[model samples]
Target chain A: MTKTRLTRRALLAGTAAAATAATLKAPAIAQNAPIKIGVITDRVANSAMWATLMGEGVELATKQVNDAGGVLGRRIELAWEDDQDRPDVSATRARKLIGDGVVMILSLSSSTAAQQAQTATLEGKVPHMSPSHSADTLTTRLNNPYFFQMGPLASFQIRTLMAYAGTRFRRVALLTDNSALGTVNATSFRQGLQQGNIQIVADETFERGVTDVTPALQRVRAANPEGIFHAGILGAEMALFFRTYHQMGLRQPVLGSFNLSIPTYLDLVPGLLEGVQFIDVYDDVKPEVVDFANRYKAVHNKDPFSLPAYGYDGIMLTVDALRRAGAPDREKLRDAMHATRNYTAVIGARGTTIGFAPDRRIGFPENGCVVRTIANNKHGHAVWRGLAAS
Target chain B: MTDLLELAVSILEAGGIYALMALAYLVVLRPTGIINFAVGEWATLASFFSVATLGWWNLPYIPGAVLALAGVAAIGALTEQATVRPMIERGAPILTPILILLGMVVVYREAAALGFGTQNLRVPPPLGFGRIDLGPIAIPMQSAVVIAVSGIMLAGTWAFFERTIWGKAFQAVAIDRVAAGLMGINLRLVAAFSFAGGAAIAGTAGVLQAPLTSAHYLMGLPLAIKGFSALVIGGVGRVEGCILGGLVLAACERLVMRYAPIPSGFAIGVPLLLMILFLLVRPTGLIGARGRT
Candidate 1:
């Protein structure tokens, strides 16, 4: 084992020497032999919008990094593959990216796809980082040290939202659609509510394409819950719920999950979301986030949301680890990535930094989520600063 | 008391769209004996048209809706020409056209997705947002509009079958395709018209419902399933059966949501469960096809 380590170190040293001698300028290195990072994203599945935004974030960050002297004196190059939102295809894409000599892989698809991609990534021993997959089981399902997760965990989101909810609501209703992600969020929210000893007065679900959510909301109103937990993710269904809620004239405050963190709802369900609070990963109060938003808008000519920040942070974090590793070796880079602590990204709550303990591979802290409420149907301002709010 | 009134309005509003979707399926099923799952996609397409006209162009609701429905009807005729007529001409099996239409469903969705991105396009309600009072019942304006529209459509459909010669021709063709052909009724014309009407009906549903759900590519499948289930529950026979099936399905689903002790997640399966139950117990549905006599 000692000899193997020595040989690996020697090989890495020789590669580093060659990389240094190849080019003095980062652009020259980019033109010649640049460091490659693979990104797996869903381009056409249910989460396509989220994936596209995240991919754009990755691109913007990579461009910025390459503009400056690239990581470890070599320019950063990205190899992107569409997983098509299928787990099996994601696994195949992971193998393909590894074959293409990607030093590390960043996944911006569903948690299922990210988990499946880890199978190939684990075998290849390549470091894989999922920027936005929050399922707690992703890192726990496999004991692969090569994989790391860095998003607001479902548990974290639920806890944060519930914390924002406080003791003001004794009896609350849980609302979500039948979509898989919505169902998962509802289940997680239920567990969080139970643990917090909050009484779930009503639990309701509606089909996605239905014209009305009144029956469900009426039931919720009948139960006379103090507040309603909106856990549904589908934009259309959520709009229906809000509209029905307003039409029914129910005065209960609505608390939404991280799904409402998506800015798409601001446009889709305008006027109906006034005073409704939802868990958010993006905090405008953060200097880093302000800088990211200003730069992103200047580049894309549009306001940047949190979805892209997840991708941006994933690539930035990967590069940070590579810079620390000082070489293109996979094992060394994995160790460097796992050692990350207090690294701030554009997407979390103010004062929350990206950190991973020795045993835990999930990089996002439990307190890194905030609750934001919609006002005037345009802006979603941060209402509760962080999860620490009682 | 107010909650129950609101619930009744909600059920009526939902059932109206379901009824229209069921009628769309029944229109094609009656004469062609083919289940065109593509009606759902046609509804999705109409929603895009509404988005273009109503949302983008800021057209009035009536004109925008009419144009969208007309566009969908043309697409239906074109689709029948492209997919159905050729298969029928070659004397393909019944399943062949059904499967082909199923393939068209994917084509329509992909076309929409490629044309309009995966984001949900905002669709404003036709009569604007808010509520109206019909005596003691407070109903959303959009829901009230939906009920009115579906009533007109059902009335129109019933009148055509009962009052018009073309409607009798359609009935003749549905009764016995070969016998109607022998009677000199143009089967091709009837088939094309049936599909066009079906598309128009489906497009109407999409346009009316778009205010609530918005225009989306993935929105087609759930509608197709729910509409198909309604068709099965109402039976493939009469126009009234479609309305009956839709109302019954909506009522059952809503009641389950309001009262079922199960998790709300399980309530979503009520429609499917009802469909399965109907298929098992009353395969002919609540109202089977109208007799030939």
Candidate 2:
């Protein structure tokens, strides 16, 4: 209302003041903006079945974080890309996700694809992790400081099972499928058996899509092994093996890999897998798992399985780092994540935690995996814990 | 002797599936001259449909399975109607249709993946999940039914070609398309019929296998490879060749791997080796195409 001087100096000064004010407000608005995290999953491939549940866990945790006032006053936003279970595709997708400003990545695809995506993650200096129950090559094949794997390795399951088998049975046969991971598990199981001085009577592998496994089963029975160590990952192959075993009236106790922990096998051949035992990273009565199952059911209207719990653990680990990071920054979060210790996770045994004590890249605790027995034809409860199973 | 008998029974069950798939390829290849690698996807889609209708919707098993099969046949007709007819009208090369059919493989697989997700779905065995203990000849009840079904389909397809007027029209077109057209046979109609008929046979194979393998989208490619191998081993000429080739291929796969003192991986190579031998020695297969140019 009070007009003073119409000088050019006065007008320039006012414009500069306005510009400075906006500059000051920018970081505050950005601080309140959602921080996007990248998620690479195999949506339209064979791994999609596992990836879907893991993705749901990530989404649930994201929603819960946002609802509880976000991390460091900034909400978490997940950018999703389906890798199609291809290694090259996952690498390209990782670069694309990084370009889109994701501070971190959670790979929920196949382990091989996740391993390849580490190429981009290492180059981009983006913190990446696979919260899936997976193979160990992601940590062993690369020395990427930014990538972390939070699951028991394929070798860990074998050692644990061997420890459980102990002197109880001196002769054991190993049966596996012909898939790549199946071969890796077979090598691990064989090494575990040989190191324990257990007699390997028969080592057999059936083809992936082969409908009949009677020939392989007959060979195992002929060897007269006291027990059978099953390294089959595919549902159909495992079902065929069980059916043939029952048909032959072989009474050897069967020990299986963590892959059998998947609930899909419950419906494959009912009444065939009643007393089978397998290795897993879950104890049904653990407080953290119990809480997670209750919370998941409260929202999803069904029970949460092992896959979802691993996913929830992955995101929570990321969120914890972000909280201590004090900013939505890739570098700061990476440093903060590297410094994490003794995180109370929803996976593993009752007192098992998520901490990278000796091995930095492999975040799962040494004693995290447990051997569970199938009771009443389901992955019922954990009966043994630790690396040696004793 | 028991091992040999069990191995033979095993061969029959696996061979039945491969035979059905080979017949599907032959049925389409006869009139259209297109190998239709998508036949495996057709089988895969039919299995997915049956599992959804029967498992998820809890529909009565027989009606659900038949309806799913009919649905796949309709898709086959629509596929030919949409793609092949136009391409033929434009006089695309024979290799062009083959390439187009390959693209349809992706389309069908992605469709099932989208509709069903990535989960392995089960198709309740129409014969139920049990075994038939015929003395020392104990076999799964589903496998016995599958073998019977395969036999009936093969017999019916053989009779149709040997006796029916439509079947003769198909043979005439396969031998001489232009002459068949000159004699008042509809070439387009035969093409559509072959695709629909091929889909029905392949879909039956898929339904039969769903109980064994648990139907999945990734299942199509492996089966397509095996089916093509069976056709290569058997011959493209006579319908019975499909069964003979299928059984032979199955025997080579199971027997050699089970009894042979070599690496198990070599067993997979044995069939491929036989296929190469057949292609080089006698390209017409075990039964040569009579009027095939």
Using lDDT as the measure, the top candidate is: 1
Q: Give the TM-score of candidate 1.
A: 0.92
lDDT, candidate 1, A1-390, per-residue tens? 999999999999999988897665335455647889999987666778688889889999999998887878788889999898898999999999999999999988787888899999999999999888767788988898999999888888889877777578779998888766677778888889999999999988777676677767767877899988878777888877878788778899988877787778778778788898888788877899999999899899998878889989998999889888989889999999999999988878888899889999999989888888888876565777556762
Local lDDT at A107 for model 1: 87
Q: For residues B98-196, write the lDDT of model 1, one tens digit per residue.
A: 999999988898899888888888888877778887777778898888889988998899899989999989888888889999999999999889999
Backbone clash count, each prediction separately: 1, 0
Q: Over the stretch A6-90, how does candidate 2's per-residue lDDT look in tens digits?
A: 5666788989999898788665425566899999998888578788888888888888888887788778889999999899999
Residue A225's C-alpha lDDT in candidate 2?
A: 94
Q: Which DockQ value does candidate 2 get?
A: 0.57
Task: Please tell me which predicted candidate would have the highest DockQ against the true structure.
Answer: 2
DockQ of each candidate relative to the true complex:
0.56, 0.57
Which candidate leads in TM-score?
A: 2
